[model samples]
Target: MNNEAANILLVDDEPNILKSLGRVLKNYSVTTANSGPEGLAHALTTRFDIVVSDYRMPEMDGIMFLEKFMAIQPEAIRIIVTGYADLEAAQNAINTLGVFRFINKPWNNLEIINAVEKGLELKRILQENKALADQIRQQQARLNEQDAILKALEAEEPGITKVNWAPDGSIILDESDIDDDFKF
Candidate 1:
């Protein structure tokens, strides 16, 4: 989906942070929450394409909130924006929680917008890969069913499933392979 169509959720205890995030992502379908609880509530009903949250909310930190949120909507891309830039927090957000981005507070508008756009691009690619994998699974199932049918046919009439075509495209059956009672 395009940026305009993508749904984004901004969660922070500070209203100013939420406002700034929302303003930066104005082109997208944006929703703001004052706390993690409210964000979770929104997640329960609406599916967001991306979630940008502050790391130090009162109800729950961004990691905790995102952990629960991921359980609810694993497909939504997760991003943490925090003024508190610590290596441990960044590692946990990226490594443990699978956050897509760790954007710092006092973020430049272009940087935030770029991060969101990249997150949307990642989401789109993942969705496409999932769809392709599903299609391949379905095709493999069909091939398996056809193989079973072929095996059954071979059991009933030996060599019936093997067709030897000559250069002229005519069936060339060996005398030994042809069943005694079989007709052309």
Candidate 2:
């Protein structure tokens, strides 16, 4: 979960904007794409921890780009950056596209850095949680299997004494406690 190791994608049609943002976010691994189609192509080919895209671009807008990006990489964090501060676009980005943050064109360097850092942190947390859940599921499956085996053994030996684990870790199936009148 090192911030420096996280991969980020920056999509903007303006070269200067891309350059400036790239410089500001130089600490992390940043990949830039000129347009929505290019960004979408890169998204399909590579995995990114975060994606910051401009709201207005040729062929496809930021909302559409983010929506498609979500389909391809649902786990990637999405952010929208644009000079045009349209309320509708911001709402759409958040409500429908699930954008992590909406940033204006004259963004503060500190704010942008913080947003990326937080996004990466969130991604790491989600990954860890998923792994822990999987491990729990695997352990539960193993316990269920053991329980089934014990039940089968009990069905076969109705009056059999409970099996114990010896000090040496071996199973001790002692039948000395069985009543004398009981058959094998």
Candidate 3:
């Protein structure tokens, strides 16, 4: 079971809602958390492709949970599952938390599955971009290190004296009489 198949976290205060939605979105690996704190804890420790959180909860609302989750797993796609459709909070959630989608409660089976799939897709793209950027940075660092090593080698070698105007720009010391420090 490769991770690309999509691992999801379903967070809701209602057990029945979680179970029903989990069953509907059975295509992916689903983990259910009954509270915002529990969900955030799981999210911090485990790797999930997407996090689907209910909008209203006792300890924390969906937007609040999403904000904390974003800090831990910025690349994880956050989907709000809520009955409340308050426009102001939804706007804030999008602006601050960067939620991928908002799904209403009593959700249609097909819509939930679709949202999960799309969220996973976005997460994969974000992860891939981050990996590519890291690889580039590492490669650049290696090149810089190699360049420094070459300069150090050039400076230490007595035979390699730079004659700026000459194409083959260097004085070569005779092999036998070379200083011990200049031996390569």
Candidate 4:
């Protein structure tokens, strides 16, 4: 639903499943990988906003693949699409892999679509929040620097309570500015 099309990666060893999922996510920029290793390779090369992987795969399961994927791209939203209804696997996907959602093998088209949309939305929010957090850190650093400068200025002129600068870039210090009663 976002104006910017999200890049999605769908991984499943089954060709038909990959095709079907890709077709369902036609609105998004989709990449398909046949195996966990292949998917991880692609993930390393390209940044996907959302990744949907089947639970059972050769060499690496969905949980392992998603976990490794997160190591490479922690910002990417992960979703597990599994035919197996293993509660343990679902819990592991959520707890270990930080999966956004888990959809059963015979996923409803609308449900899959909704899940992908929600994943993309979460990705967008995370990116925005990260940007905002970086800005806050930068501002805090600047504020700290300003505070240090003010402290240094006060240290240099202990008696001076107020400093007025003229338009001509000259400092105006008056006798009344001296806080004689104040002790540093």
Candidate 5:
């Protein structure tokens, strides 16, 4: 695990709710957003590893926030803490937003921390995967460029010699390898 602390975003329209959750997660790096649109703006610009949102809010509900958040930052792990667990809303959260978990209102501090920790773990794994994928892509590009150079060297006229190194880092051809048809 990384020694760095987790970056958490607390989103809720109610000032009291945001303050309470912020206090609960005081040990970590916490950023608060008051509305869904405000949260979206912050999330798009900020670098948060996880987002915890209240389900009931004016202007935009948790569901809508989740949707917008997923579009902008798909790797972020999300949790919905709501006073009411309507089956329809729960289903929508799962199907549309792919929320990591759901918590009932009046949550336990320990439980919230645990969920946030789990979300951070998942985010780390995703970041690692993305880095590995980018490395592979760069390596492939380098190989392609090398291949092009090798092809160009090979296409030289008969008078030119194109020599390469062996896997053991030894030159494949010395002066003796040159024949009447090819010159160094």
Candidate 6:
């Protein structure tokens, strides 16, 4: 999806962080939630392409919130922004939770915007992959059904489904040999 059409969610206890991030990402549709529960509520009601959360919060930490958020919207790209940056938090966000980006608390405006754009691109790629996979599955199912039909036809009439190709690469059909029920 394009930036203008993509929906982004920002969850942080600080109003300033939310506002600043919202302002920087004004090109896209942005939703802000003050708490983990509030973020989850928004996740239930809306479909967001990306989610950005703060690591430290009163009730639920960013890791916990993002874990629950993933359950709600598995496709949404996740990000954790924290002032208290630690190796453990970064590793957990990346290795376990599949958080796309870990932004420092004193994040550069351009860096944050770049991260959002990259996250959006990842979402688009994933969505396209899913669509292609679905199409491939549907095509495979159709091929299987056709194979079954051909097999049944062959059982009823031996070599009926076999091709009779001429030297000119044209299909040769014997109209008199084919029954009315076999006509295509």
TM-score for each prediction?
0.94, 0.86, 0.74, 0.85, 0.76, 0.91
Q: Write the per-residue lDDT of candidate 5 for residues 2-117, one digit (tens) a residue.
A: 41467778999888988999888887788999999999999878877889999999989998888898889887889999999688888888888889888998889899888888
How far is 44's C-alpha from truth in model 4 (Å)? 2.1
Compare the candidates by TM-score and give the number of the best one: 1
Quote model 3's TM-score.
0.74
Indicate the residue-level lDDT of 76 in model 2.
96
> Clashing residue pairs in candidate 3, if any?
none
lDDT of 4 by residue, 57-130 (tens): 98898888888898999988899998889998788779877889999979999999999888878777888899
lDDT, each prediction: 0.91, 0.91, 0.83, 0.87, 0.85, 0.94
lDDT of 5 at 163: 50
- In candidate 4, where is summed lDDT lowest over 10 consecutive residues? 175-184
Q: Which candidate is the best by lDDT?
A: 6
Task: Write one digit per residue (lDDT tens) for candidate 2, span 1-184.
Answer: 8967889999999999999999999998999999999999999899999999999998999998899989999999999998998998799789988899999989999989999999998898999999999999999999999989888888998644476889999987656765778846
Please list the residue runs of candidate 4 whose C-alpha ends up more than 4 Å from where it truly belongs after superposition. 1-4, 161-184
Instruction: Encode model 1's per-residue lDDT on 78-175: one tens digit a residue.
Output: 99999987989899789988899998878999989999999999999999999999999999999999999999999999878889999999999788
Candidate 5: regions farther than 4 A off: 1-5, 157-184
Tens-digit lDDT string for candidate 3 (1-184):
2344778899999999999988887777889999999999898789888899999999888878888888888878888978887888888888888888887777888898888777777777877899999999999999999888878878898535443354576655566766789888
Can you rank all candidates by lDDT, best first? 6, 1, 2, 4, 5, 3
Error of 4 at 34 (Å): 0.7
